[model samples]
Target: MALNETHDEYEQQDLKRNLSNRHLQLIAIGGAIGTGLFMGSGKTISLAGPSIVFIYMIIGCALFLVMRALGELLLSNLQYKSFIDFATDLIGPWAGYFVGWTYWLCWITVGIADLAAINNYLMFFNDGIAFTPVEGAMISIAAILFIMGLNLVTVKLFGEMEFWFAMIKIIAIVVLIAVGIWMVVTGFTNESGAVASFSNIWSHNGMFPQGWGGFLAGFQIAIFAFVGVELVGTTAAETKDPKINLPKAVNSIPIRIIIFYVLALLIVMSVTPWDQINPKVSPFVNLFSQAGIAAAAIIMNLVVLSSVMSSMNSGVFSTSRMLFGLAKEHQAPQALGKLSKASVPANGLYLSSVALLAGAALQYFVPDTVRAFTLATTLSTILFICVWVMIMISYMRYRKLRPELHEQSTFKLPGGVFTCWLVILFFIGTIYIMSLETDTFEALKVSPIWFIILIIGYFGFYKPRLKAVVDSKI
Candidate 1:
């Protein structure tokens, strides 16, 4: 191995941070806005009642704080390509292995869920169309291939694709929110709710329509809305002008998504009332239908189509990077770090796609109308929270060990170390709340199995890894 500063077995840092401002901007939005919000809003609001507003706000706040911690760390040290890399370098190899793999799993599961959503959406217009699990699996794998192709062509092309995709989602949400507000102002009346107003929220079950019981229940559903928030940090390695733009993208996006989720859901609930909104029907579609637009379903299908694909694209991109980071540290297969001339980790992209092929198989062999998005999403949020927790812990140690780097930071998490501890506690409480949710509880019960494996793997292999790495260096 060349002992030159930049070269190890390969030029570990050969991949340049070439992504521009627009790419980072859209990529940030691409991660946060998904079709789930468009389609799942009605169901979540109905289940949690008018209290769903606070559900979005609360999770949004906690998630923003989590992003704050991430922003501070990424800005202070732009050498770290992604959050997982930061965890590995700061926390140790065990964390690198655990965070990288779990994060990849998180995206793989999300990709499958989005694939299922896409196929189901297609079914809406094709009334007689039938899809077996086999067909669904094929569609999902095909979607993965499409995303891999985009990523492999050029990161910018993938960013451009996401840029337009996020634009569609952004425009759709803005239009929906505006029309919803207009409906409220004009006193729009619907079959489900005679005269819509702020009172529509209270007319049925009130703000806590299901009582405090429902508000608490809303937490379970609300957590999933924060799924892609950390994705903002994933682009750090490729992000051009990361110190300046990365922070701005991370800080501004969470606020924008928060407003979109809370205000939009509140308006939708106000227009339709909690009881009238059907999660299955999609509130976006109902918004158009209630507005008497003949093409509401058409427009919503188009918006959600873009949204789902953008999310899948992001899942492919982020998970590949995590795998790439793992490989760099020798915590995973070195093959994962190999970059193609396009600067994409072609191996991880294709390998993760292979994992997603399992989805196609599952869909073909035994596709259920429900793959249990609620629970799977809940499990993901919990796992994602753990990654965020690790970020704070890693950052905490960084502050303790590298006080000199704090001055280099253009972006720092507001309030310093105390907030890190607070955020960690917030995560712990989130897990407690997960147990409170019956749907999420099943996931919580099973989640420990993953951590147990992590523990076993740590004791079993990680120690030897450090020795092997050192001996190799010698």
Candidate 2:
């Protein structure tokens, strides 16, 4: 069915059931492999040393629970377009209004930051690449435009690109881990022929090299690395067979977390020694170079570049889809939902690409203007949390409002209402943890202003006195 068809007609098509199993599986891993793992992990390792592994482990558990909860709810009801769609259906239209827009905002800002990071990483090849900022921004802008072109061509092509992009990181990580194990066994440490071995992990202050304080501090970087974990859910609308595919995705997510985060870090710190890690540089690149591996920096740069492109691609794809959904709900301009001959949301994709040019512009005011993007992302996080809570909340309301649906639902939350509250409290606790961090606190301190901007914009543009009507049969 064409997206341009009447709302009644479009809703009748199984938009929720189109995503395939392989697509879902790759997307789950692909989304998780953002530049953070490739570029951001170096900073995290410097802060906590060997203990960063433990920090990742803890985060993985919490995030696992969150994804599991999301899976149970999404599988239970194919009616949900995605979380924002579900939120609107279960909560009020207002919750969907807030979440859909906020998530779009998050992707835009994160896209900018990742693009900036990409430009900086590109400097590895030539220290004198460009300092005028325009040169760097131009490179990312060009990349974004290229990706925008690709995505508008077809959704399946975007999936294919993500699969390849993600594969590069996976291969890099696997090689690193394998090499690390060999280094450990061969006892190859210093150039003097002394073996490094696993002792590096505990050689300092016994794993918690900077004490518990450092371990806790590492969460600042660690949490952000996990930012796009929800990317799989966004693919729900276009997936080929979400029911089987989604569970495959949710189950494999934790395993990838173990390999990419825990094992990879354990290996890096094991051979290099925690104290020797440079915060300003990538530990992965640093390790291979120190070991005299050929073209270490080049390989690492290429891998990180793939990461940047993947993120840009995802940003373009996700933001457009959100706008498409919001348009359906009358929370955004209706034109955004209009599809092209290719069945792709073409306008939304182009608009998001244009939005990222501001990211290129962001290069000018950075270190200062960048704060705006940072706080924007925080509010973005808050907004995502709101949608997640709304998901559980919507489920509760669905149960009460339509008990018959609950009785026949195939994938209900296991513990019923009790688990729902537990997830809610878990969501609240994450916010509390954020409150304790000075930067996150500052970002959140200004979060209300963002909401004000959103609310004002919503009222001015998307507000409608007309009724929201969904056919019962759909």
Candidate 3:
């Protein structure tokens, strides 16, 4: 339980701090944007109309506080490599075990969904290459292996890969926004005779086109878009200067949310009326095609493909690190803790890659890939809520048990303990909203079985082993 004991245990074979500030920054940016925004926003806009803007802002604000709490914790104890490590120390070992395993499951679920999405996107290229679902699954598997190889090389290589991936996303978004603005300014009219104008956002039925129920429905899908926003917290151990770089990355959340989510959606809705936006197609592709761009689908296809790759790459990096942390804590198999000569957790990476291959199989065998993806994404979102709540809970406990650390801390969470509770309440409200819908409710109902299994594993395995370790130390 002592800090020195934990520190000494990892001092000999800890992960190297090869992630510079730039890599940390883009990783944070890339994490905030994902395939969900690119492909799923069409549905959200259809459901919430213009009100989707408020939905994203609300979620973004709440998660910013969550990241602030995480930033404070990581800085308070340099020995704590990731939030999972400190969750085990500050809350209890069981907290570490549950959160670590659930987080791993979260990414695996996300990777599965991404694989399915990648397959769907590949279909857009059928006109040129004649790709099939089987080929899509095969390509997905190859991409997973490629990501695993990049992660195994060195931490810097992983950073560099994320950097370019993030750069591509940023450029695509910037271009989309600029093009939308130009269309509005020039009073351009598309082939359908619908003129581009800022008034399209509310010209259909005033902001709440689908009413309050529709706005509420947006939360279920929109939350999935923000799944990996906390990937920066997982990178704290490898960041060059945790105190400086961590805060810089965390504090920029608001700007990223505004420009990336709010403004981008605002432009999309302004160019194309909410009523005209197809729920099944990406708004980006729809707007580009409407503007008479011949290869709009192909261009958007490539952009969306890059977004999926970025998300899957992050999944590989995060789950591997979570497994590594669990192994170090004796919550997982010991072999997962071993690092290669390059100071990478090679075994853990391989384990995660092997698990991701299941996504390919699911895509190939499942006739209803979309339904399967929906369920997996919903389950992943539920577990992510649990992880974020535990972070807030851990912060509250830190303030009570370690007031001196709070007093001496350089980066204190803005609202302190009060905001932690508010964030928890916000997450609870989101879950309630999810339960009101049929499709999401199914996943919500099934998600508890994961926790039940984790609980049984804790009592059956982890608890006794942890007690013995403590007893031997005494």
Candidate 4:
């Protein structure tokens, strides 16, 4: 097929290059900081004590290498839409099909969790309004439709929304960190006589208060915090100036991790002793409330709500694009490949929104937010790890088959194929750790069902369809 003929296809409609560098940078930051940091950090601190800080650093470092490989691959060929395209070229058609579909589900699951979190957060204001379950579900449906409508108009609007939403999260953390610093400097103490000081980090039971075992346990939840960090790569097709913008966003992962993840938690642990922090409540609100911010809970609730919406927005955008990519390759329904007049994947977006409504349905069915959220997030985490592993494998193949590309590449992955091997092993080890825990283990047990369905679909549907296409061409 000629390039022009390919360009004219429904899936090949050129996505507008309207995402500016600022948009890309904030999107990367937004991906790094998830609702996990806001709500789950207290639990992680209780698990690992002060060592939770180190855990975030280590995970951040490993994922940076993963992003580096992704950046190089996307930049190596501007034509490659996302990691899916490269996986297809270097690994095999099966790799592309699995990764593309899995990546789409990764976002779907994340969106589900985000929607649930958002509804729960909205309950903070319900004391006055007395919001019921039906009302909450209606609000969630409305929120999804609102975001979907925004996405249908322009990709630039999506970038703009993420930028402001991420700014809210960044400001909240910075304010909290500043307040923590002041408290530590003045030797402020809460009602329990626990003085705010850096000593709080190590004074209680030492840094390794939970021992190596607890430190390892922290990885189970902290890993989920980084789930959406690869989101920048998905925006490659719509980004302005891929070579410059993508690398800038990718390389900043470490700095973002240090500031947002490590430093924010460091401040939290410093102001409030790790053992004193309640795992059931947000430490972010705890710190501010103790500091006499009377509206801390209300303020933090709004911040977290925005953060969840930001994540869900990214999920909606990426899942549609993944479906768009899958359809282009004939791995999905051809209709999903069709583009809207605005160049948006409208059908894909609509389908993903329908899938997301399951979150609201889950709220009605499950009712227990904690159990439902944990299962959904754990399943999403497992699927995301699968996608990351495929990226690493594809990178290794890229190096072996296209050594010259690696050689000539200005933004080559450090440690080259060696880093790829190490990252893959790290993910495998993360999975083993997950299996030891009851909640995560249950999700792990259920994960294979998705793959089983995929396998049947591949053999029963995809394989025969490919054969028929080939026969027709002949």
What are the models' TM-scores?
0.93, 0.88, 0.95, 0.95
For model 4, residues 366-450, the per-residue Cα lDDT tens digits are: 6655666777888998999999999999999999888898888999899998999999999999999889878889999999999
Residue-level lDDT for 443 in candidate 2: 68
lDDT of 2 by residue, 218-332 (tens): 7655766776778888887788777878777887877899899888888888888777777656777777876877586679777877887888788788898898888777677
Assess the local accuracy of residue 265 in candidate 3 as a C-alpha lDDT between 0 and 100: 92
Once superposed on the true structure, which residue ranges of model 3 sit more than 4 Å away at CA?
1-11, 128-133, 471-474
**Candidate 4 lDDT score relative to the true structure:** 0.86
Model 3 Cα displacement at 277 (Å)? 1.5
- Model 2 clashing-pair count: 8
**Candidate 3 lDDT tens digits, 29-147:** 99999877987788889889999999999999998999999999999999988867889989998899988999999899899888877776666666534345577678778888888
Give per-residue lDDT, candidate 3, residue 420: 93
Candidate 3, 260: how far from true, in Å? 0.7
Error of 3 at 454 (Å): 0.4
RMSD each, Å: 2.5, 3.8, 2.7, 2.4
Instruction: Tell me the TM-score of model 4.
Output: 0.95
